[model samples]
Target chain A: MMPAALSEATPLLSVRDLTVRFRSGRETVTAIDRVSFDVPRGRVLGLVGESGSGKSVTALALMRLLSPDMAEIAGEVRFDGRDLVALPEGEMRRVRGRHLSMIFQEPMTSLNPIASIGNQICEPLRLHLGLGRKAARDRAAELLAMVAIPEPRRRLDQYPHELSGGMRQRVVIAMAIACEPRLIIADEPTTALDVTTQAQILDLLRDLQSRLGMAIVMITHDLGVVAEFADHVQVMYAGRGVERAAVRDVFGHPRHPYTGGLLRCIPDFDGDQDRLVGIDGTVPSLTNLPPGCAYAPRCERAQDDCRIVVPDLEAVAPAHRAACFHPLEFAREVSP
Target chain B: MLNYIARRLIYIPLSLLLVLCAAFVVLRATGNPIDIFLDPNHTPEQADVLTARLHLDQPILVQFVIYLRDVLRGDFGDSLQFGGPAMPAVLDRLGATLELLAAALGVALVLGIFGGIACAVWRDRTPDFLISTIAIAAQSMPSFWLGILLIQIFAVDLRWLPTSGRGDGWHLILPAATLAAFVLPNFVLITRTSMLEVMGEPFVVTGKAKGLSAAKLLFTHVFPNALNPILSFLGIQVGRLVAGSIVTETIFSWPGIGRLLIGSIFQRDVPIVLAGVVVVSLFIILANLIVDLLLSINDPRIRLG
Candidate 1:
């Protein structure tokens, strides 16, 4: 990990009190509540959480891809210096896929089935870079090659249905990086692929990040992925940030009880655990969350204070913070 | 692809044979065509001669065998009323029907697809509500009633178009619009449903994330993906329009094959009636073939097979 002082300079993307609420009929549910984090330049920030933890919503909000009538987002999304939340949609369109791009989950359904692979990749090139048809076509083939696709020139003329799941994902990655954006938000990018393919995709992403020097907000539920790829990590529970720290600090000295529970749940093949430990309950519904803390009911170290009052995320160690009145003590190193 | 087309072509003759048999059986059951030529002045011997000369005196099976042989040799007997070969007379009227069909189809496609896009894009809003309501109303209305209504409003009251008959482009407005109204509702409903489903697809969001403008995303991404269902529906509509035009053509007194078929049926003109049926069915079959080809072109997933 980089030294704290060296990584403390202005982040490439800084989100502050970012909130997203979805309105249906008369009721409004907060999907993301005052969530905040920073993605330093040329670094990966893993936003780890289970399903419905607002990770995907946070990614879409950052890109302003959510429909305004359904989702109401408020707060700051400062990218490189401009307040993206305040940027007009017309101007924001220019920033998206040019300076800030995204990679989505489920590569099987994320591409236009009717369009040729070449055309899909060329779309972003021509739209953002204003390249002509021939130039875009040439660039698209190059991008396919960049993603390590074999016979890139021939693959360009094929459709999504003609390619395998892993190959399609490579195309999606190529599209995301067409303009060499400064940051890429990858939301569960490998969740739909098989074990070996997932590893290969992650490896490809890591290689591209290091080579291109672009920041990434890696949103995933797999702690193994975070440990392997993310430089900094933030854990979320029921739409709120639960803990924030460097990857080593999070795994070595987990401060939040929820975070401790998550760590214990990861199966240890070498340790001879017969069964994996599991968190006791499901995530609370966003529309009907408890008054004090959403995770208090399922937390092992829940106290009266935890039940009655929600704890704010506070500094527990240097560059580490956890939202708990009784933060876990640094007992042992558990890096796997 | 060539093999697929050849396979599809093999089925046409078999279908046409079935259609011809059904037409022959139905017309024979409707009473002898010779009876329509009879009067009080005819003697019994003269009636028998008339029946034998027209080959109506033979058994139904023998008559069908002879009719099938003649049809295979490219021979449909002269029209009993018009005194000419039935095939040419029917083919002559095909141009008018095709003209009306083309005009109505053009109108339906433009209005239905755009209206559907508007409805899907503005889902749950005033435009969606209004367009859906109109589509439902249009779908429920009968073609003949709608045709008359158009004539009364545009031709009678406003005097903007002719009341009936085929003439210049001005004369086509009422009939084509009426025919279009019959199929337009289906187009709107199908397009709207297909478009709505596609808009929710992950690729659409992918397009949006690529910084594509909303219009580009809709036309290039959403609309093309939604086109498969619409194209299939268009095939069915073409067949319906050919048959449904009988009513519209009658209302406008347009000199199309539909009007000719109606006139021949009343006159008990068996040759002309059979010719009209075969011609119309052939058109429908060819239309379905074209639609299938277009579908394979539009979506590469459908490899003609």
Candidate 2:
């Protein structure tokens, strides 16, 4: 990661201590607990986590799409000096799709099968921009072309099922950027695609982000994705952020034990003649999380103090933070 | 596509065979049409002459074969009661009957879909509750009884519409409304349940994340996905509506196939009765084919890869 002086710019969006809990039967399950992060303008923030790590929850909370009956949320989401959580629903709705939009993981069902691609893309334009039908449709075609779909004009009449999976995902991306939002939160955008298609989509996103200069929050469980594109990385575990810093620092230093364990889980073809390693145990059940440090039972260096007290996210060095009792100094202690 | 059409084509003859077999067995088992044809009190000479002339003296198998052969050649025989060829009379009445059926179904479909949408969108609210309760009540009530009540209110008391007969265009209203009511509830329940379920699917969630407003989400995303059930239910409902038209048509004195069927039943017009049954069955089979074609047009997943 580049030094702070070279990258200094006011962050575009800021999130703090965001917690979401759902009540089921007689128990309250905390899904996202005290997760905080920032999205610098024109930069990519990768939120890497395993399933049930609250990465999706954090992204959804950004748009206030949580089921009203099931989940209760508490957090400060400051976007351009405004508290998004405090915004009225009508205002929030206007802000959504126009200012903050998302590209969902699965393009298959995300699209309306009956509607022509034109109508689906032009929907937000008509709603938010108040564009008339003709203008909206024209813009929809333009967006299709912008997404590199061939024969944009003719494709407008076609239904979603007419297109392949990769094309549909591109159509979804076209819709996501239809309003030219400042932040595009793509939630595992390639999770449902083949590897070759995944690579193509990732390239498209990076190219679009570079050209358009929108802040992107790339949420994924794939460390490889973060390593490739993310300017900054935040590793979340048990509904909270365990490590956050410049991408290189987090991977090169990897202060937290859980972070190190997760990194080891990703297969390294560049080194090691052996088979891939793995982290033990599934994600802890949200309904019955352990006290203090949620990852303590799984941590290799955990001791009596680590078990008793949950460590706070503290700065171990400039612009690098971790929630661990002992930071790994393997690189510093061992000569290259 | 050709394979599908071929399979469907084979069912046509296969269906006709089943109908002919049923007609033969049921007509024979109920009462010998010959015995009914000749009065028992008739003199022996008269009965013998009638039996020999009509080929009643022939074996049952021979009679069935001859009857099946004539039917295949489009000769439905003469109506015993009407004193004319049964084919022309049956075909003429079929046109008017089908017209009424089509009109009634149209009314039912438009109302049912709109009502279902209202209920699904409003769900558990007053409009939804009112529409559902009314539809269910209308469904549960006998169409014949409901038609009688309608005649009593709108025809006899209020004198708003014609009371009976297909004398004027106004006469079709009461019978059509009654039939529409009968078909309404099934479509209402099916469409509403399907729409609600589709609304809960993950795609709808993804749609919301894309910032589509509530209205677009309902009409475009939710309603279209909900169309499959409605299409499937259409075939069954049309079949039932045509079959159930009998009592309602009789009650309202509507000049439809159902009324013709009843009149033929008392006259012991065997050819006319068989024609009526065949006509109704054919319509049902055709409606199912139309529904299939519609499904293919609406959903790509149904096609063989």
| Best model number under TM-score | 1
Off by over 4 Å in 2: A1-9, A25-27, A125-158, A270-275, A304-310, A325-336, B1-21, B28-32, B41-74, B91-107, B122-178, B300-305
Q: State the lDDT at A81 in candidate 1.
A: 79
Among all windows of 10 consecutive residues in model 2 chain B, the one with the lowest summed lDDT is: B296-305
For A250-324, candidate 2 gives per-residue lDDT tens digits of: 778788888888777776566753876777777788877777677888877888787788788889888999988
Per-candidate Cα lDDT values, in order, are 0.92, 0.85
Q: State the TM-score of the second chain for every model.
A: 0.92, 0.93
Among all windows of 10 consecutive residues in model 1 chain A, the one with the lowest summed lDDT is A1-10
Question: TM-scores across all candidates?
Answer: 0.95, 0.85
Q: In CAPRI terms, where does candidate 2 land?
A: acceptable
Question: Relative to the unseen true structure, what is the C-alpha lDDT of residue B9 in candidate 1, on a scale of 0 to 100?
Answer: 90
Report the C-alpha lDDT of model 2 over B23-90, residue by residue, as the tens digit.
87888887766677666677878877877766778998898888788888878778887878887878
lDDT of 1 by residue, B215-276 (tens): 99999999999999999999999988987789999999999999999999887788898889
